[model samples]
Target: MICNVFTQSIKRKYLVLAFVLVCGLTIMVSYYKPISHRYMFLPDTQVANLNFYDQNVISGFVFGKGTPMAVSCPLLLSGNKQEMLVAQSFKRTTRIPSFYYSYLAKNCSLFKSRRNYITSSLTLEEEQFPIAYSMVVYKDVEQVERLLRSIYRPQNIYCVHLDNKSEPEFRETLTEITNCFQNVFVSKESLDVRWGTMSVLEADLICMHELWKYKSWKYFINLTGQEFPLKTNAEIVGILKNLNGKNNIRKSVLNRWATRWEKAGKAPAGIIPVKGDLQIAVNREFVDYVLHNKTAKKFLKWCSKTKVPDETFFVSLHYNKHLKIGGSYTDDQGNSTDPPYITRFKTWEGTAKPCHGKYVRRVCVYGVGDLPLLINRKELFVNKLHLDFEPLALDCLEETLYNVTRNEYFQTLEGNGPPKHT
Candidate 1:
């Protein structure tokens, strides 16, 4: 009997050990599994259902295997011409009404789950050095939601300013989306933001004031709803870290619009008026100075009365040396030839390299053909992708970004070096 009892105890110990090893192996496999496989088991939802395109094709395009011959190349190059044609046909025929977003935002948990937002910080550096975004949006709730998801990071903060002219349903749906995330909120003030108008600058300022309350953010990037990020959050953080507190705003010689400001006597004295694109990447100190400094406040007031104030206000302040603004560079620092602005990439209507996508207001609305150039461009973000024009372009780009983000996260786990983007 004594021998039998000892044998039984030994058997129990062996069984326990076997169970432990199996559990350890299972966990390791689960942890090391690809994100695509993990998501495959998730329930079908708008965000959860990511198998909208062939993984092989997306991977090939993103990794630069099957680049199109030209900007106007047919969708046949993407490896799914029929599907692209069908999607394009559907988008052209159907209109996604505003209520669609209202329904999607109804259940916050399911909404987030389906959207598959990266709820945790991917890296220590990204978490510690948070970035602030001010998104000014008016139409296309679907595109707006996709853009938010593509750039969403829990560590960062976002303040969305809707055009006052936007429909009431649009505002409600946007608020619903923002409410789902603790870090994102809709701006209390809304403006009827007309193109090239002071309202555009005012809308940005409203968010700037709101975003300033969050003291932890390192940089501020303003984006429109139509824009999408070319780089992942980690990549953007890496680039911004390299800036060493210098602002990224393109400075051009004063345009014909400057004469209007001068003739109206609204241009600030002792301040040379300069013009630039409205999209900017500025540091927190610059934002604070723009909000609190006396000269900046006066310039803002003067800009309010001037035409296309949004294009001139920030660049003028950044180019002026006397302001001593953090990250400010003066005209003497290579202002004659405008250095490339890496913040945003946009193709105008009549460039030597014509827009492959249709032009809306002389700006390219990126189509499926433009993916080759877009994927290879070194800019942080690409401007103007419309869902109605070519849903496949946005779809393929979103999938590409998803793959890049997943690869980046796994690369971090393997102790690989950081992502390098020129």
Candidate 2:
């Protein structure tokens, strides 16, 4: 009787173990559902529900260029009509719930976790050509992400400045994206950015101050979230190197007389006031001058009370003969200042009426129609590309840039020459 009782106890333990294993396997299978039939990666020939074949309508939220982007999509709730409907609605209208972020966070490991960047180029040699960026964005997470991806390189440092007045969700989304990459970070100080106000300059200055601690960076460029690079990272780095230590801040031809600036009581004695669209790319020495120079500090204080300080501040600082950083102070041979000014392509609403899209705040929203003009221009970057307004333009531009880079890289591998000119 004792032997029979022991045999039954052993049988019960085996049965319990089998049940536990079955349950664990079921949970694992349920957690990782198959990707949706309607989903496919971009630039592929497959026709998913995303309309990937539609060259004009495909979304620009692609995760990979040449790298593999592992994506997981869940359509398990499809059997439930109500849940499916809600999910579809969100995907169409807001895209707030999608597999994009999962892939972005997991497979896109191009970013470095520390200041020490590692380069893995197959053709080009590993070199430290770190560029610092100050990108001030208030909204449009999709566009911002697109811009960041298009310009992202492991060697560069990016400081994102979010407006204090932005919605909580918007701020959180940006923070989450930036947190995934160590090279990209939210500025320690955020300002309530007001249009045509000094707050814009202040926000950029805060980012500049933070980036200054990394003395290895060679150049700094300020951008809004709406901008996209026309040149590849290698091309941009080459351009900066050719600058040979000069700054590229656009000097305004609008302000002519010293009296006009004097009337505002902001112009320093014997300092000429200048204006530009306010985008600037400068060398480390130029940044140092603006940050530590007593005159530049006084100029900043004076511009605080002036109208549209961003338009005038950087240009004025760059052109200051006392600073001797910009082309104005250099020789006229043009060799000292290659491809003068911060050449960013921006179309004003008053002039270019946006052939394919609407104007936002007197600035043309570039579209597919503007591609010829934009591509032919000698600008390093183009401004005011909103995904909601003209997604195709960004897509086409990205494709063009990718092809150019790929061709150049492959040519280098074939013993042709270094990647340049595209």
Candidate 3:
């Protein structure tokens, strides 16, 4: 009787194991429901849906160039709904480079958990204002990734915009790069990063608008990816703290603050320049005023009718409306002492209003590349510097970080934080 009982028990165990194995296989297949499995990563023929995420994969966002960014915005969402491989499955099947986060982790402390920043003396808490970077990636994306790795701390976030005209392969690569950021974001309009004139300011507004909407960051700075720092982060905090101690930043902002005058029944054509766009330092109050002001919002609404009305639009408003409040100072150049505000770099030589008149495209070199030449616009917070200036800016060191341009970085206290992890 004991032998018979043992034999029966062993048979039951085998049956139970077989049932469990079958159920496990069913669940695995459900999670990985095969959708046109292609053993390719990031297809060039068309950007396909990534199949493996617990989340739904949508159209790929691109980065384009110029002030208004004619091409970038259209690329925001894709209409391509072709049958494709899952991003996870494709990645597993394809032989691409193994992934890692050396840039966002070691370089910028963008993610929430890693918010420590190091500078000469700026303590993290003392640095009252927030900073934002406006970056556009074109070719040399690998170099761009390296630039992101070297600069921008977590305290400051990067708003990256790509041009739409870039190759599909490059676009897919960029998508992978920015996915690592909690703080870093891809812009809505993917303009041509290299060609468009409006791309510069367009990127600025995008960053400012989104940062204002999402994060509590008080200041908005427009920094390019290629140009590294000229000053230590700590010195920046000190400068901003000192500025706040003296000025009323709320009444000031960087925009063309021109109000519409009732002249001969024409539309509101009046305009003036703001102070922050002067390539200097900024405080929280100023950023809030321009980005959140009811009057400014109305002004923007009015200006929308003007044909590509970006140039001098913000400037006219900022300088004219706020001038009475003792907020902004102007510089005509060829005059000795630096204006109350300072700009870090020289602008591309051309009349800003080319669309209304005859304007020629210009080549820019910030470092070794033939990038579009641009001044570190004090206005628009930070504008694209000619890439030729990157190494120079890197060498200058202190100037890039803390000096007061017209309307840029803020001041604060010294920092005691962890050294970067290489």
Cα lDDT, all candidates? 0.78, 0.66, 0.40
Evaluation by lDDT, superior candidate among 1 and 2:
1
Which candidate achieves the best lDDT against the true structure?
A: 1
TM-score (all chains, Cα) for each model: 0.78, 0.73, 0.47
In order of TM-score, best first, we have 1, 2, 3
Residue lDDT tens for model 2, 43-140: 33322432332222222222123311111112211133443333223322323222344323432342222111223332343146778999999987
lDDT tens digits, residue span 218-323, model 1: 9999999999998989999998888878889986663565564864474664787788889999999899998999889899888877778888899889888787
Ranking by lDDT: 1, 2, 3
Candidate 2: list runs displaced more than 4 Å: 1-126, 256-263, 326-328, 331-338, 352-356
Give the clashing residue pairs of candidate 1, or none: 47-114
Each candidate's number of clashing pairs is 1, 0, 98
